[model samples]
Target: MTVLVPGIEGRSACTEERLLIVGLGLIGGSLAAALRSSGFNGQIVACDPNADEVALGKEMGLIDSGGTELAELLENVSMAVLAVPVLAMESVMKTLAGSLSAAAPNVVITDVGSTKATVRECAEAVFGCVPSNMVLGHPIAGSEKSGVSAANPSLYLNHKVILTPEPDVLLDALVRVKTLWQACGAEVLQMSVERHDQVLARTSHLPHLLAFSLVDTLARQDERLDIFRYAAGGFRDFTRIAGSDPVMWRDIFIANRDAVLSSLDDFEAGLARLRQAIECGDSDALIATFDRASHARHYFDTLLNKTSYQAEYHMQPHGKVTYRVRPGGQAQGRLRVPGDKSMSHRSIMLGALAEGVTEVKGFLEGEDSLATLQAFREMGVAIEGPHQGRVTIHGVGMHGLKPPAGPLYVGNSGTAMRLFAGLLAGQAFDSELTGDESLTKRPMGRVADPLRLMGVAIDTAEGGRPPLKIHGGAALKGIDYDMPMASAQVKSCLLLAGMYAEGETRVREPAPTRDHTERMLNGFGYPVSREGDTCWLQGGGKLTAGTIDVPSDISSATFFLVAAAITPGADITLEHVGINPTRIGVINILTLMGADLTLENEREVGGEPVADIRIRYAPLNGIDIPVEQVPLAIDEFPALFIAAANARGTTRLRGAEELRVKESDRIQAMADGLATLGVEHTVVEDGIDIIGNGNDQVPSYGGGRIDSLGDHRIAMAFAIAALRAGDDIIIEDCANVATSFPDFVALVQRIGMSINVGGDNV
Candidate 1:
C-alpha cells in the first residue's frame, strides 16, 4: 500500500522529484507550464475526468503523463497539487488519503483553493486530522478564461500567494510549498486560516459576487443589448470578473458563506444610506460621500501602482494636507524628537569623503537627510541605512568617488545642494546637483560664486538659482573670504572645498551659525582651528573615519517647547535635545519671554552639549528679541512666532533677513497665518512685531485655514497653535513635514491634542 520514491540527493537540482496535479484545468495546467519553464524537469502527471482535456494538456507538453485516476497518481508522488473546484476536492482528498498509509508517508499536499476553511475541513475529515504535510494556499491572481487551452505560463508572476498553515504544520512541508510558489514568480505570504478567510471575504469574494449579480441583473432587462452596447469602459471594467467560471464561483460563495454574508450585510447597510441620499436629494451629503470615496479610490490606485501621480503630489490632490487642530491641551511626559538634521547630513557627506569605514549613531531619518544619504549612494559610495537612527558608511576617501551616472537629486534639501557643490568642486569628475521644486527656487549663487572665485568652474540658473553644475578637474586655490551674512551652510560649503584647495582656506562669518560641521570635521580626525568668527582649514588633508552621535534636533524640539509654554497647567520634558551654543537662541528667547523653562542633566553627545529641557506653564511677557540671537534661532522662528502671539505685550524681532531665502519666506508666511487668527502683527523686510492679546490666560487665537507654503516648520507651528486657539485651525500643505519631523502628528496626538485628519480620526 505504501509507495517509495527516490531521495533528495538522487535528483538533480534543476528537477523536482515528482509532482502530481489533480485537476488539469486552467490553474493546474498553468502550474505545469510554469514549473517546466522554471527548469523543473521532473515528471508532471495530471488527472482530469474529460479525456479531451487530458489529451490537449499532453499535446501542449504542459504535463508529461495524464490519467483520470487519482489513486494511480498518488504512488511515488513527492507533492500533490489540488487545483480542483471545492465540491470535487473532498472526493479527491479522500481518494488520495485512502491510497497512502503511514508506513512511508513523505508526500506534501497543498491546495490552490480560493477559500481555505472548507477545503481544510475536508482534509481533516479524510485523514482523521489535517495532515502536517498539507499547506493551504490561495493565489491572489486569476484570469477570465478557463481550461487547459487557456492556461498561461506567467499567470502568477508578481502576484501574491497567501498560505494558511496550522500551528503544528511540518516546517519542511511549509518550506517546500513556499519554494514551489516562489519558483513560479509568486510572492508568498503566510497568515492564520481565520484571518485569510475574513480578509478574502471583504477584499475578493464580495467584489466578485457584486460583479456577477450586477451583470446578471442587467442582462435580464428588456433593453439589455442596447445597454451593453452603449456602456462605457468603466462599466465593462467593473463587470469584467463576472465572466469567471460559474461553478468555481458558486462553490466559493457557498464555502465562505459566513464571512461573505457578514460582508454583504455591512455593504447593504452602506448601500441603503446611499439610496436614501438620492431619494431625499441631499446634495451636501452626496458630495461629502463622493469626496471620501474618491480619495480612497485614488489612494488604492496608488497602492496598486496603476496611477500616474508623481511622488511629491501623491499625498494630496494639490500637494496639500489640512490638519484640523482644536485648542486646549498641555504637553506632558518625556519625549525625544528626531535626530539633528544638520548633523545627519554632514555625517553622510564627511563620512563618504573620509578614509575607511565610518559608523554613525543618532542619524536623522527624515526626508531631507535621507535625500542626502541617497545622493551619496547615487555616487560610488557604499552606505548602510539609518536603521533606527544609525548608519554605516563605507568611506570612499578623498578623490576615490566615481562620477555619478546622472544628476544627483537632493529633494528639498538646500544644505545638501550647497555643501555638495563644494564637495563636488574638489572632485576630478563633472557633477550636477538638482532638487525638488522648493529647493530649485532657493538661491545657490552664494555657494557657486565663492567656489568660482576659488578658481573652480561652476554654473547655476539665472539669478544664482539651483541645478548647480560643477565642471570637473579645475585647479582650485584657497582664499580667505568674509561671508556677507552668517550662514552655517555657506561656511561649511567653502570649508569642504577648501579641503582640496591649493592652500589654506579661511572663512569668517559676520554672525555665528550652527557649528555642527566644524565639530564633526574634527571628530573625523581632520584638524582645523577657529578664532572668534573665522575658521581656517588646510588643503590636501585626508579625513580618518570616526563615530558620530547626533543629538535630537533642537529645531524640531522647539514646537513642543512652545506648546508647553503657551498651554495652561502644561509640563513636559524634551530629552537629549542638542543645546549647541549657536542653536540655543530659541532657549534664550523663550527664557527671556518669562517661560518656566529649565535645563537639566546637561552632558555632551558627539561634541554637542545635550540635556533634558523641562518646561512648565508660566505667564509669558513679550520683549524685543535680542538682535544677536537672530541667526541662532533662525530655523525656529515659525514656532517662535506662535509663542509671541500668546505672550503678553508686543514682541519685536529684528535682524532676521536671512529667513527670506529658506524653504519659504518664513516671515511673510507666518504673518499671513497670524493675521487670519486675529493676531495683530506688523511685517518689515528684516523683522516682525506682534502685539499680543495682553491676556496670557486666553489669547485671541481664532480658527482659520493656514497655508504652509510647502514649509515643514510653518505647518508644525500652526498645529501647535491649536493649544491656545479658540476654535479649530486648519493647516494646509503639511505633507512636507517629513523633511524635518516625520512623527509630528503621532507625537502631538499622543500628548492630548484634539487633532483630526480631514474632519475624521480624532
Candidate 2:
C-alpha cells in the first residue's frame, strides 16, 4: 500500500541521487534548509503526518516533494535522516524497517535524536541488530522557536555536532553523515554512546531539569505574578529553557533516567554541603567553593580563545601560527603589559602549598601561567578567579597535596617542568613531569642533579632531559650545593624542594640570578637569607597565606621599550612594570647604549618593585654587553638584538651560551632572522655581533620572511623589527605568542603598529 504526493512536475533535477528527511519539524526542516543553502547537488524531500507541514516545506523550498506516508518517500533515497522525537523513534524505525526492506538496501540512515542510547536501542530492536548504515548524532545548538516556519540555515554555524557511530558501522554511511554536518558549518566530533550520554546528562539535561523545576515551583506560588514581574535578567536567562516543549522533554528525561538521576544526586549532595556552610557561617568554605568555580571558568575561557581546534573540550594542540607585519608604525602610548610570568607561576605553586586562602591580583592569563595553574588544580587545590587578573587560591597547606591523575604536561615551559620537579619530589606520592616537544629537548640535568644531591631518587631521559620521574617517600636531608651555572629556574627548584627537606639547605651561585622565589618565600613568613654570593633557607618551614600584586612582565615590556628606543620621535610609557633588581639587565644594557629610558613613580608592591618606565627615541652607540649582565637580561636579549640592529655602531654579545637552551637556539634563531633581513651579524657558538646602521632617516635593514620556529620571544622580536625595515616582514610560527603575550597583536595594533596575525587554529 503506497501513496505518492507529486509536486515536482516543473522542478529541475539537482542530481540523480536524492535525500529524504523524515519528520519535518525544526531539526528536520533546518537540515533541509542548510543543505539547500549549501547548493547540494541532490534532490531533497520530506515526510510528515501533518499535511500542512508538508505544504510549508515545498513553499519554503526546503524540500521539492513530500508525502504523508513513510513508505511513499523511499524513492531512490541515497540517505535518510530521521529527525523524530526521542520517544517516537521506536515507532518510526519499525515503519522504516518494514518499508525500506528492498526499496533502498544500500541507503545510508541517520538520526538527530537528543538521546542516543534509547534511539540506538530502537534501531537494534527493529532490525534484529543495530544497522551498520545507521549513524546517531546530536547538535549542541538551536533556537527557542520551533517548527518548519522557524527553520534557520545558520543554526549549526560555529557550533558542535557530535556523532556517535558504532565501531562496526559502515564506513561509507559514517562518511555521508559527517559530510552532512560539515556542510552545515559544524565542528564535528566522535565519541562513545555511553560517554555522550554521561556528558549531556550533567551539562545539558541536569540544567534544563533544574530550570523547569524552579519555574514550576515559582509559578505555583500564591504571589507568582509579583515574583515573575520582579525577576532579574539572570533569573529569566537561566529559566528560559523551561519554555521548551513539555512532552518532548518528559520523554527525553524518561529515556535518559539513569544518567539524569546520577547527575541530580551529585548536584543535591553539593547543595547540601553549601547549605551546611551557610548555616554554620563558614566563610572560608564558602569562599573556597565560589572562588574555585569563578577562576576555573576564566581559565577555561583562556583555553578556548587560544584554541583553533577542539578547544571547548580542552583539547587544543599547539599548532602553527604566523604573524605578518608591514614596515614602519609609531609606538606611542601608555601600555601596561601582562603580569610578570615568573611571579605568576610562583603564585600558583606557592599558593597551593600555603596554609590558608591566598588572594592574588594581576595574574597573567597566558599559556605558560595557565599551564602552571592547571597543574596545581590537578593536585586538588581549589583556585578561583583570573577574571580580570584576580585569583583566589584555597591552599592545601604544606605536605597536603594529593597525587595527580596522570603525568603533568607543562606546555612549552621549561621553567614549569624544572621547577615542578623539585616541588613534586617532596610529595608523599610519586610523580612524573612532562612537557611539549620543545621542552623535551631542553637540558634538565642542572635541576635534576642538584635535587638528587638532596636524596631525591630521580630518573630522567638521556643526558638529563624530561620526562623526569621523581620517586617520593625518600628521606630528604638538606645539603649545601654550589651550582656550576647561575639559572633562576635551577635556583628556584632547589629552594622549593628545601621546604620539604630536613635541616638547612644552602645554595651558592657563581653569580646573581633573579631571586623572586626567595623574596616570595620571605613574604610568605618563611625566612630566606642571602649573603654576597649565597642564599640559604632552613628546611621544613610552612608557608602562610598572603596577598600578591604581580607587576607587568618586563620581558613583554621590552618589545615596546625597544620599539621606542630605536624609532625616531617615538615616546612610550609602560605602567606598573616590574623592576626587580636582578631582572633589569635589558634596561641596564639600553642605558649603557645611551637610549633615553626613564624609570618613573618607582615603588614596591608585595615583595617586588614596580615603576612606570618611559622610553623615547635617542641616538645610540653599541657597546660590548657586559658579561655580568648576561644572567640578568637573558630573556630580553632577543629584543635587545633588534635594538642592536638599529644602534649607531656594532653591538657585541658574549658569554650567553644559555641562549642555545631556550625555547629555540635563540642565538642562532636571531642570527638567522637577522640574516633574512639583510642585517649584518656574525654568529658564534655562544653569542653574536651585529652591525647597526643608526641613520633614522633611512631603513636599517630590508625585510623578508623569517621563521620563528614557535619561539614566542623570537617571533615577537622580529615583529617589532618591521618598524625599521624597508619591506613587509612575515614571521612564521608566531602562535606561541599566546604563551607569553596573548594580546600582542591587538595591543600593538591599538598603539599604531601595522601587524596582521594569521593562524590555523580555533
Candidate 3:
C-alpha cells in the first residue's frame, strides 16, 4: 500500500495529493493536459491496459507518471477519474471497488462515460451499492480522434460537463468532482442520471449513429468514389463523426440503447413523413416543415444567444442585453412600429378557439406575441405562416383544444397568461400557465379572483402570482362584477371564461382598457355588447373564423413620438399606428402638454382606427394630466416622463395607481431613471411631478447609467430620453425589449438615433 510512482527526474510532484486518470486516451489525456496547462499542483498519473499509451502520456508531459496496473496506481490517489468506454465500465468499477480501499479515505470516484445509467448500474453491482463517493459525470466534449497522442488541452474549454449525482451522494465528493471539471475550463452542471442518459442519447448518441449510418450508406454505393470526390462542406461536416473510433461509438450506442431507440423512432417517423411529402409534391406541407424548422433553428439560436422571443422564456444567465444612446440624435424619418401586441395576442387565442381557419396580417412577431402563438400550437392547433407578419391558423373550434403536455410558458406577457387562465378554465383537462420572472411577480390576483367567482378552481403563488394552475371542467356561471381598477387583462379573462359559462357575463371597468379582445371577439362572430361602462357577452356562443388586419402599436411608437417632441425641429411621422380610443392616452397627454402633434391619413381598418401621426417639434408646456386619461395611456407613461423632463414647466400626474403594477412600477422606474439623468422629479404615492428644464438650444437633462428594472418600456423610454441628454445614456437590463419591439434599436438608428446596443445577447 501507499505506492510511490516515479516521475520524470526534473519535475517536482506534490506528495500531499494525487489525481489518477484511468484509460490514457483522448479524453483522459486531454484532462491531464488541461490540468497541466491550468497549473494544477497535484501529482498527475494514469492507469491503462496499454503500456505504450501510458509511456506516451508521460513522454508528452500530460501526466507526471502513469502505469499499466490500476492497482499499483491507486495508492495516495485523492480522486480517480474513469475515462474508459461505456461497456468496459463494469470491469473498471470492479477494479476500483477492490483497489480504492488502499487510496485516501475520502477518495472520490467519477466517470466520463457517455451513458450514466449503465455506469451507475455497473457501480452498484460492483460495490454492492453505489458508493457515497461516486459522482456520475459526462463531459459534453470530444473529438473523432482517439488514443493519447490526440490530446487537446482546449477541448473542454467553454463546453459543458454534467454531473449526475444521486441525492444520497456525499456533498464533498460531488463538489470535488465538479471542481475538477471546472478547473479544466468546463461549465459544470448537475442533473439526474435519468435525465443525463435521456438527453445525451438524443443529442449526442443519436447524432453519432446517424453520422456513421449516413456515411456508411453512401459509401456502399457504386458511385462512392465519385460521391466522396464531389462532397461539399456540409456533407463532410455531417459525416465527420463517422471517422471516430468505431469500437467506442459501438459501446455508446449499446449502453444508451433505449433512449436512442426512442429518439430514432421519432426521427424515422418524421423522415418518412417528409419522404411522403416529396413523393406527393405537397408544397404547403414541405413549406410548413421547412419553414417551422428554419424559424425554430433561428429561434434556438436566439435562445442560446439570449436575444429574441425565446430568450425571455429561457432566462439564461450568461448574457444581459444593454443599450447605450449618445446624446442628441435627430428623430426625422417616417417609421411604423410592429403590429399592436394586444391584438396579436388576441388573434392567436380567438383564432385557436374559432371553428374555421383565420387569416391574420400585420402580426407582431415579438416574444410576448409569439408566446401566445406557441401556446396554441402546444394545445394541438395547426398554425402556419408567421413569416412576414402573416399567419394562417386552422382553428380547433371551441371545446376542441387538447390539453398541453405541460405548463404553457408566456414569456413576459401578463396578457397572454390572464387570457389563457379564462380560456383553460372551461376545458375538460387541467392546465397551468407560467411566465418569466418579471411577469410572475406582477399581480395575477386581478385575473384569478374574477375567474374564481365564475366557479373555476384555480391556484396561484402566495401573493396570487404565477404559475397559475386552473382545474378544468368547472361549471361556470357568469357574474356581474365591477373591477377595482381598469385592467384589460382582468376584463378579457372574465369575458373569455364567459364563453363557456351558463348565462350572461357582464364586466364594468372603473375606466376603459384596451378593447382588442372585445372587438376581435365580435369580429369573429361572437356577440359582445358594450353599454356605458359595462361590456357583456353571453355564454354558450360560438366563435367563427374571420380575417384580421392588425394595426401598428401606438405604445411602441410613443418612444419615437417623445423623442421628436423633446428635440428641437425634430419632426417625425409614425405610419399606420393604431389610434384605438381606449389606447390613445399618450397622444391625449402629449397634446394637452402642448406638443404640435397631428393625425393624418386617418382611416378604419378591421374595425380599429388607424392613422399616420405627424408630430412637429414645438415647445411643450407641462400641465396637470387628467385622471381620466391615466388608463388609456398606462403603458406610455415612461416615455411621456421623458417628454415631461423636457417641457417648459412642471408636469403633475395623479390618479395613476395602475402604473404601480406594470412590468416595472412605471412611476418609480421612470422616477429613478429620471433622477439618474439629473432631471427633477418628485415621486408621490400614485403619481409623480416632474419639473421641466425645457430648452430648444441646450440639453434638457444630463445623462447617466440607468437600470431599466428589466422592463421593456423603461428601457426604450430611456433609450429615447438620450435624445435630450447632455451626455451618453447607458440603459441596463434591456433584453425584454424584444418582447414588445424586437427592432426598436434598428428602427431608431434608421431614424437617426446615435445608439450602440450591445450586451451578452445583443
- Residues 638-716, model 1: lDDT tens digits: 9999999999989999999988889999999999999999999999999999987646556457988888887989999
Q: Candidate 3: lDDT of 133? A: 76
Candidate 2 deviant stretches above 4 angstroms: 1-17, 305-339, 356-396, 399-486, 501-512, 529-539, 547-552, 564-581, 591-628, 652-665, 684-686, 703-712, 727-762
- Tens digit of lDDT per residue, candidate 2, span 1-762? 111312121113223338888889888899888877876768888998899999999999999999899887896787788887898988988888887767866677888887899988998888877787788999887665778998988888778899999888776567667778777778889998899999999988999999999999999999999999999999999999998778778988999999999999999998998999999997766866675465456555644554421122233434566778999999899989999999999988998899988899999878788878777876778777567889888898988888876787677889899889889889988898887778899999999898989999999999888899989888888889899998989889998999899998899998899999999999888899999989988988999999999999999999999999988889999999999999999999999999999999999999799999999999888899999999999999999999999998899999999999999999999999999999899998889999999887999999999989989999999999999999999999887787888778877887778987666321
Top candidate (TM-score): 3
**Clash-forming residue pairs, model 1:** none
Candidates sorted by lDDT, best first? 3, 2, 1
- Candidate 2 positional error at 112, Å: 1.4
lDDT of 2 at 159: 83
lDDT of each: 0.85, 0.86, 0.86
Estimate candidate 1's RMSD in Å. Answer: 23.9
**Model 3: residues with Cα > 4 Å off, grouped in runs:** 1-17, 221-236, 265-292, 300-307, 310-318, 759-762
Task: Compose the digit string of candidate 3's lDDT tens values, residues 65-138.
Answer: 88988888888788889999989999988787777765555567889998899998898789877887788999
